[model samples]
Target: MHHLGVSLIVFACVFCSAVLGMYLHGRLPDHHLNDESMGVVKLTIGLIATLAALVLGLLISSAKSSFDTVNGEVTRDAANVILLDRILAQYGPQTDDLRVLLKQSVARGVQIISSNDRAQIASLHTLDAYKRGETFQRKLQELTPQNDMQRRLQARAAEMADEIFALRELGLLQATGTTPIPLLVTLVLWLCIIFCAFGLFTFPNATVTIALFLGALSTSIAIYMILEMNTPLDGLVRVSLGPMREALTVLGQ
Candidate 1:
C-alpha cells in the first residue's frame, strides 16, 4: 500500500478513538468521572505509551539500518563494476569487446534497479543482462594470456563480476523486504488507546480537539516514514544512483 493510504488509516483509527473517549466521558456517571479513577487510567495509558515509544524507536532504527545497508551495497557494486572494467582494460585490446558487454550489462542492471515495476524485476533472472554477462564470461574463458599479469587481471575481473552479480541479487531481495503488518497494527492499536485516554480527561474544547488532531497527524507521519524507509527503492526515500552513474562515466573514458 502507498504511504498516504497507511497514514490515513492511522489517522482515522486514532482520531476515532479520541472521539469515542469524548462520547464516553459525557455519558459516564459523576462518580466515575472523579479525578482518582481518571488518574489510574492515565497511569495505565502512560505505561502503554512508554512501551509504544520504545517499539517505535526500534522500528525506526531497524528501518534506517536496512536503508543504509542497501545503499552501501549499491555503492560497492558500482565500484566493483568499474574495477572489473579497468582490470579487463589491462588484459589488452583483445578484451575490448568484453568491456563493451560489461558496460551494456551494467547499464541494463542500473535501469532494472531504478525501475519499480514488478514485471521487469521478476524477469531479471532471464533477461539480456545474464545473456551479456554469460557472453562476457565466455569471452574471458577464450582469452589466451601471454603473461602472468594478463592471466591475473583476467582472474580478478572474473571475480569482480561475480561479486557485482551477487550484490545485485542481494539488493533485489532487500527491495522486497517490508515491515510486518501485525506489528504495525499493534502499534496503531496502542496509539489509539493512548489517544483515547487523552480525550477522557481533557475538556473537549477547540484547543483540546486541535491538539489531539495534530498529535494524531504527527504520529501517523512517523508511521508513514517507517514504512517508506523499509522499502528503499519504491518510496519517498531512495538510495541515490549517483555511484553507478559515476562508474559508468569513468568506464566510458
Candidate 2:
C-alpha cells in the first residue's frame, strides 16, 4: 500500500479504537467496573501494546532485511556471471562456446527469480541444459597449452555459477522465514493492538460497543495491509521488479 493511504487507515483505526473504548464502557452489563479495575486493565493493555510494538518492529526490520538480501543476491549473481563472461574471453577459442552458454545460463537464472510463482522455482533445464560452465571445465582439462592461468580463470568462472545459484536459494529462504503468513505474526500483533485499545469496554455501563467494533474493523484492515507488505509476491504490495530489470539491461549491454 502507498504511504498516504496506509497512514490514513492506521490513523482511522486508532482513532476509532479510542472512540470505541468510551462507547463500550456504557454497554458493560452489571460489571460495575470500579476505577481500580479500569486502572488495572489500562496497565495490562499498556503492557500488551508495548510488547506488540516490539514484535512488529522486529518483524518489519526482518522483512526489509530479507528483501534487501534478495536484491543483493540478484546483483551478486549478475556480477558473477558478468565477470565469468569476461574471464572466459581469456581462454581464446575454448571460451567462445562457453561464453554464449554462460550468458544464457545467467539470463535463465534471472528469469527464474523474476517469474514469481509464490512457490519454489521452476525447472530451468530447458535453458542450454544449464551446463555451459561444466562443458567449459571439461574442455579446459584437455587443452595442454601453456595457458594454465587461463584454465584456472575458467575454473573460477565455473565455480562462480554454483555460488550464484546457491545465493539465490539462501535469499529465498531468508525472505520466507522472516515474513511467512503461516507464522501468524501479523495477526498476533494486531490482536494486541486492538485489545489494548478496546480495554475501555471494561466499564459495566455498556456504552462503547459500536465504537469498539468500528475500531476493531479498522485495525483488522491495517493488519491485513501490513501482512500484504510482508508477503509481496502473493499480496497487494509486490516487491519491485525494477532491480531485476536493471540486471537484465546490464546483461544485454
Candidate 3:
C-alpha cells in the first residue's frame, strides 16, 4: 500500500479506538471507573506508553540512519564518476569515445534514479545498468597503452570503474525497504491502546475530541515519515540527486 494510505489507516484505527473507549465509558458500571480502578488503569497504560515511546524512537533512528547511508553512497558514486572521467581524459584523446559513453551511462542512471514513476524508481532496471557497466569494463580492458604511464592509468581507471559498479550494487541493495512490517504493526497497536486509554478517563466534548483527533493525526504522520524515509528514492522524502546531476555535467568535459 502507499505510505499515505497506511498512515490513514493507522489514524482511523487509533481514533476509532478512542471513540470505542468513550462508548464503553458510558456503559461500564460506576465502580469499574472508580478511583482505585482508574489508578490501576493509569499505571498499566503508563508502562505501555513507555514501551511504545522506546520503540518509536528506535524506528526513527533506524530510518534516519538508513536515509543518511544511502545519501552518502550517492554522493560517493557521483564523485567516483567524475574522477573516472578525469582519469580517462588524462589517458589522452584515444579515450574520447569512452568518456562520451561514461557521460551517457551517468545520464541514464540519473534518469532512472530520479524518475517520478514509483514503478520505475522501485525497479531501477539494475540488470540493464549492470550490463552496461560490464560492457564499459570490456572496452576499458581493450585499451592498448604505449608506455608504463599509460598502462598505470589504464589499470587505475579499471579499478575505479569496478568501485563505481560495486557502489551502485550496494546502493541498489540498500534502496529496498528494510523496515520490519511486524514492528510497525505492533507499534500501531500500541498507539491504539494508548489512545483508547486517553478516551476512557475523559468526558467527551468538542475540545477533547479535537485533542484526540490531533493526537491520532500526529502519530500517523510520524509513521508516514518513517515509511517515506525507508524508501528514499520514491517518496516525499528522497535522497538529493544534485551530486549525480553535477557529475553528469562534468562527465564529458
Q: Whose lDDT is greatest here?
A: 3
Estimate the Cα RMSD of every predicted model relative to the unseen true structure. Answer: 1.9, 6.1, 1.3
Candidate order, TM-score descending: 3, 1, 2
Model 1 misplacement above 4 A: 125-135
Name the Cα RMSD for model 3: 1.3
> Candidate 1 has what TM-score?
0.92
- In candidate 2, stretches whose alpha carbon ends up further than 4 angstroms from where it belongs are 1-24, 29-31, 119-146, 178-193, 196-253
Off by more than 4 A, model 3: 122-126
Q: What is the TM-score of each candidate against the true structure?
A: 0.92, 0.66, 0.96
Q: Each candidate: what lDDT?
A: 0.84, 0.56, 0.90
Q: State, as a TM-score between 0 and 1, how close model 3 is to the true structure.
A: 0.96
Residue-wise lDDT of candidate 3 within 40-154, one digit each (tens)?
A: 9999999999999999999999999989999999999999999999999999999999999999888877897777567776555557756788899999999999999999999
Measured by TM-score, the strongest candidate is 3
Q: Cα deviation in Å at residue 131, candidate 3?
A: 1.2
Q: What ordering of candidates by lDDT runs from best to worst?
A: 3, 1, 2
